[model samples]
Target: MTTLYSLYFSLVHAFVGLWLTQIINRRPRLLGTWIAVFCTNVGLILSTAVYEQTGSKSAGVAAVAMVWVYNGAFFLSCSSIFFTAYANPVAMRSIGWKLYRFYTAILVVTGILIYFVIVETRGYTLQKIGELFDGKRVHLWVKSPVDDKESDGPDDGEIRA
Candidate 1:
């Protein structure tokens, strides 16, 4: 049963990767930054799923190969995020490297903690999961809604009440 579930997930991951890659390749310019991010994330997901499925079985060359692929995909995804930030020279200049360094450190630490510490909330209610992260440690995890007036800007003629 567990093996079947793993195989199913692996197939689904591969399918999603192939579908998204086709779409991304078709549209070379539209949302290129986000498309790169999405493709990297899909690669990470596909590799991780394949690694888990292979590693659960007896150790062999296939398992070793999957591990290598998973490690490469993981680092590639992380580096894509960094490279995206690096490409934004104006933001880098205004915000400074210290801020970017801090952001990257936070991202890395969060990823590590999530992989090690986070529990599966598969059956939990939304409120239950929200409560789990509703502390100083999880600050800014949930976004505040944007006020209509603020989003409307000065020229867009939606009259304020």
Candidate 2:
């Protein structure tokens, strides 16, 4: 599953990636930026869905796919952001240094959150969020009880008084 998803997305990712890069490069629009942001989210979702379905398969492959999808997508948006900033650094200056500082702070905070959301959770299960690609929830090693126990008896002795 990992190999299949990776192979499929990698091909699709290139076309999308190039489209975004050109959009920011040749024809820049606010709408395009918004679309790029949405595309980033879409990319994250695709990679995540694949991970969830195939988490039990291979940890390393899952990690690679997540990184590939996320970093590639985020790079598109960040590159566009930086390009816009480069094009109009004067606009940033107009807001004053304090606002610029605030802007930078927000970027850092949001970047961290985005990384956690997209990348960190990719190689994990619904329960073991910290670890990557474990079959069970985290390292709990919860062994399912044998079926014989249920069929053994409802109760060994039951006295009704």
Candidate 3:
């Protein structure tokens, strides 16, 4: 049963990863970033099933992975609260504008930061990626030179791993 569950988990992640890659390849960077942030929250749901039935070091590793993923889950709950406050009639009386407006401002600011901070890493090989980050801070607006080239990579909808 555990093996079956693991297989299911792997398959789900495979589909999600493929979908994410397609989005990243075809859409705006801000949209891809939002999708990634949303996906991170899904880890909290999967964490409960990570523990192995057998008592082993692998189980401990799974527990650690759960904790790591759990750290990102707070963003999901906070977003939900803000959305609820924005949508509810009674909640709109006092704090709705402040809460939801603040949330929107934060989202916009973070989206800008993510766009500037994250390097679009679609076609670069692992070695090329490492070299880019190896010795210096990458500056904003530095587009990858490989953008025009066709990527024979998984982002083209072919799963590599």
Q: In TM-score terms, which candidate is top?
A: 3
Ranking of all predicted structures according to TM-score, beginning with the best and ending with the worst: 3, 2, 1
Best by lDDT: 3
Model 3: per-residue Cα lDDT over 1-161, one tens digit each:
96465445545544554565655552353455455544443442233234333445665565556534432332322222344424645654655323334444555666676666656667865545555667443222323466765444444333344
* lDDT of candidate 1 at residue 149, scale 0 to 100: 34
Clashing pairs in model 3, backbone N/Cα/C closer than 3 A? none
lDDT of 2 by residue, 1-161 (tens): 97576556555655565676554442232234334444444444454445556664554355445456444554444432344436435754565223333434555566555544433343334454434444343332333376433232223221123
Cα lDDT of all candidates, in order? 0.43, 0.45, 0.46
Error of 2 at 144 (Å): 33
Global local distance difference test of model 2: 0.45
Badly placed stretches (over 4 Å) of model 1 are 1-72, 75-111, 116-119, 135-161
TM-score computed on alpha carbons, candidate 1: 0.22
Clashing pairs in 1: none
TM-score of decoy 3: 0.33
